[model samples]
Target: MDIKSFIDSTYLKTAAQAGLDENQNQEVLKTFVNEAIQEGFKLIMIRPEMVSLARKIVLDTSAKLLIGTVIDFPSGNSTIETKLNEASQAITEGADELDFVCNYEAFINGEIDLVKSEILKGTQLALANNKIIKWIIEVAALTDQQIIQLSALIKNVVLTHFSEADYNAVFVKSSTGFYKTANNEPNGATIQSIIMMLENASPLPVKAAGGVRTYEDAVAMIQLGVKRIGTSSAKEIVHRRHNQNEY
Candidate 1:
C-alpha cells in the first residue's frame, strides 16, 4: 500500500505539559524528525515553533518530506487575524502544510458567517503563500447533522470563492485530537465520523486525524478514500507492517 506515503507523522504536544523542559522537548522533536526522514513518511506535523527544526532536519536528506504545523490548534476560538499571523510565521519558517482548527464552536452558536469567514481567510492566506491548507472540523465536538452541515459549508466556501484547480489544495480534516468531550466521550476520528465526512465533503480531499493507532486502523481509513492519515503512531504503524511482511 506504500503506507509511508499516506502517513503524516505527528507530534504537537507542548513541552511544559509533557513534563519536559525546552532542551528535552527539542531532543524529542529531533528524534521525531529523524524518524520521519528514515521512514519516508509523507509529512511531519509539529507545533509551529518546531517547523524550522523539522525543515532543517530533512533539508539535506534525500527524502522528499513535507513540513506541517497546526494553526489555532486544539481550540478554534482565536480571531482570524491571529490565525493568519501564526500561519504566516509558520510558512516563512518552511511549513509546507497548515492544518487549521475551524471555529466549530462559533458555528454551533449560529455564528455561521464568522466560521465561513475564518476558513475563507485562512485558506486564502495559505494558498497565497503556496502552502497547503487542511480545515480541521473537530468532528468529536459536534453532532452528526452538524458534521454534515459543516463539511458542506467548508466545501461551499472553497468552491464558491476559488477556482476548481485550487480545490485539491485544501482538505477537510477530522479532529484536532485535542477536543475534550463534555461527557468524557472519546475524541478524534471515528469510523462513523469519517464516513459522514467523506460522504458530505466531496470535491475536496479528506484527512482522518486522531485515534488512528494501529496499522489495521490506518489501512481501514485509507480504504475509505482518505487522502491522508494524521497520527502520532505513524512510526509504529509502519513498523508493524514491516514486521508482518517478514512472516
Candidate 2:
C-alpha cells in the first residue's frame, strides 16, 4: 500500500512537555529527523522552532524528506496576525508545508466571520508561498454537526477564492493530537469524524492525525480517502505491516 508515503512522521512535544532539558530535547529532535530520513517517510512534522535544524539535516542527505511545521499549534485561538507571522517564520526557516490550527473555538462560539477570515488569509499566504497547507479542525473539540460545517466552511473558502489547481495544496486535517478532553476521552481522529471530514472536505484532501497507532488504523484512514496520516508511531506501523506480510 506504500504506507510510508502516507505517513507524516510527527514529534511536537516541547522540552517541559517531554520532561527533558532544552539541550536534551533538541538532541531528541535531531534523532527524530534522522530517523525520518533513514526510514524514507513522506514528511517530518515538528514544532516551528526546529524547522531550521530539520531543513539542514534534510539538505545534508540525498533523501527527499519534506519538512512541515505547525502554526498556532494546539490552540487555534490566536489572532490572525499571530498565525500569519508564525507561518511566515516557519516558511523562511525552510518548511515545505505549514499546518495551521484552525480557529475551531471561534467557530464553535458562532464567530463565523473570524474563522472564515483566518482560513482565507492563511490559505492565501500558504498558496502564495508555494507551500502545502493543512487546516487542523481539532475534531475532538467539536460535535458531529460542527465537524461537517467546519469542513465545508474551509472547503468553501478555498474553492471560492482559489483556483482549481490550488485546491490540492490546501487540506482539511483532523486533529493536533494534543487536545485534552474531559475524562481522557479520545481527543484525536476517529473513524466517524474522518468520514464526516472526507465527505465534506472533498477536493481538499484530509489528513488523519492523532490516535492512529497501528498499520491497520493507518490503512483504514487511507482506504477511507485520507491523503495523509500524521503519527509518532510511523516506525512501529511500518514494521507491523512488514511483520504481518512475513507471517
Candidate 3:
C-alpha cells in the first residue's frame, strides 16, 4: 500500500506536555525527523514552533520529506485572525503544509457563518503562499450529523471559491487528537467517522488523523479512500509492512 507515502509521522506535543524539558523535546523531534528521513515517510507533523528546527534537520539530508505544523492545535476555538497569523509564521519558518483546527465549537453553537469564514480565510492564506491546507474536523468530538454537515461545508467553501485544481492541495482532516470527551468517549479518527467524511467530502482529499496506530488500521483507512493518515506510529507500521513482505 506504500505506507510511507500515506503516513504523516507526527510529534505535536510540546516539552511540558510531553513531560520533558526543552532539550529533551528537541532531541525527540530530531529523532522523529531522522526516522522519517530513513523510513521515507511522506511528512513530519510537529508543533509550529519547531518548524524551523525540522527544516534545518532535513536541509542537508537527501530525504524528500515535507514539514507540517498545526494551528490553534487540539482546539479550534481560536479566532480566524489568530489562525491566519499562526499559519503565516509557520510558512515563513519553512512549513510545507498547515493543519488548522476547524472551529467546531462555533459550528455546534449554530455559528455556521463564522466557521465557514474561518476556513475560507485560512484556505486562502495557505493557497496564496503555495502551501497545502488541512482542515481538522475533530470528528470524535462530534455527532454523526455534525460529521456529515461539517465535511460538506468544507467542500462547499473550497469548491465555491477555489478552482477545481486547487482541491488537491486542500484536505478535510479527521481529528486534532486532543478533544476531551465525557464518559471516556473516543477522541480521534474512527472508521465510522472517516467513512462519513469520505462520502460527503468528495473530490477533496480526506486525512484520518489520531488513533491510527497500527498497520491494519492504516490499511483499512487507505482502502476506504482516505488520502492521508496522521499518526505517531509510522515506524512500527512500516516495520510491520516490511515483515509481511519478507515472509
Candidate 4:
C-alpha cells in the first residue's frame, strides 16, 4: 500500500486556541473539521466532546470520524478509572478509534503494572465496541531504556487489528505538544525507538505526532511504515492542493 494513505490527522479547534472557551472553540472545530473532511481527508481524530458533532457530520459520508483525546492529556497522572470512563463516553458518543496517553510518571516511577492496566483497559474498551485502539507511547518524555521497555511491554497488546494479535497497530506517538519546550528531544532517536518497537511487534504501526508539521515530515513518517500519522496541521499540509485550495 502507498504510505501516504496512512496519514491520519488529529485535530481540535479548542486545542488550536490557547485561551478560547470550550463552547466557542467547539464551533471553530466544527467548521475546521467539517471543511477538512469535505476536502477528502479520510481518517480524522477529534476531541471527545466534539465526537457527536463530528460523527453527525461525517458518519454518513466517506470520511471516517475517529475520536482521540488525551486520557490524562499532556500528563498521564489521572487514574485508570478516569481514563476508562472518558474512553467509554467517547465510544458511546461514536468514537471509531482511540488515541490515549500513558501515565509518564507511573512509567518513570516504576508503576509498570499501572500503566499496562490503563492501556490494556483502553484497548479492551475500544475492542468491545468494535473500535480500533492506538496506545500513545509518548516517546518524548521517556529515556531510551524507558522507550525500549515501553515498546517491548506494549508490543504484546492484543487489541483490534487487521490480522492476528501479533499483527498489531500500536501508535508510538511523540509529544502531545503539552510541553513543546520539553527537554526530551523529538529527534531521530525517538522515531528510531518507536520504529524499532513496531518492527519488534511484527505488523504494528507507529504514529508520529507533535513537531511533524510538514509534507516532508509526513512523507518521511510514511516511509517508516507508519500507517496512521497524528498531526494538527492537516490543513497546512493540504493547503496547496488545487482541489483543497478554496478553503
Candidate 2, 119-235: lDDT as tens digits: 999999998999999999999999999999999999999999999999989999999999999998898999999999999999999999999999999999999999999999999
- Give the residue spans of candidate 4 off by over 4 A: 1-4, 13-17, 59-68, 157-166, 180-190, 239-247
Pairs that collide, model 1: none
Q: Measured by TM-score, how close is model 2 to the native structure? A: 0.98
- Per-residue lDDT tens digits for candidate 4, residues 13-90, read 454454777777777777866776665666777667778887777766647544455555666678989988888888
Better of 2 and 4 by lDDT: 2
Least accurate stretch of 10 residues (summed lDDT) in model 4? 158-167
Candidate 2 has an lDDT of 0.95
| Best of the two (1, 4) by lDDT | 1
* Model 3: lDDT of residue 137: 92
lDDT of 2 at 129: 96
Clashing residue pairs found in predicted model 3:
none
Model 2 sits at a Cα RMSD from the real structure of 0.8
Candidate 3: tens digits of C-alpha lDDT, residues 1-247: 6788888999988899899999999999998899888877789999998999999988878578899999999888999999999999999999999999999999999999999999899999999999999999999878999999999999999999999989999999999988887898888999899999999999899999988999998999999999999998889989999999999
User: What order do you get sorting by lDDT, best first?
Assistant: 2, 3, 1, 4
Q: Model 3: what TM-score?
A: 0.98
* Candidate 1 lDDT over residue span 139-242, tens digit each: 99899999999999999999999999898899999999988777877698899999999998898999999899999999999999999999999989999999
Model 3 Cα shift for residue 140 (angstroms): 1.4
Better of 1 and 2 by TM-score: 2
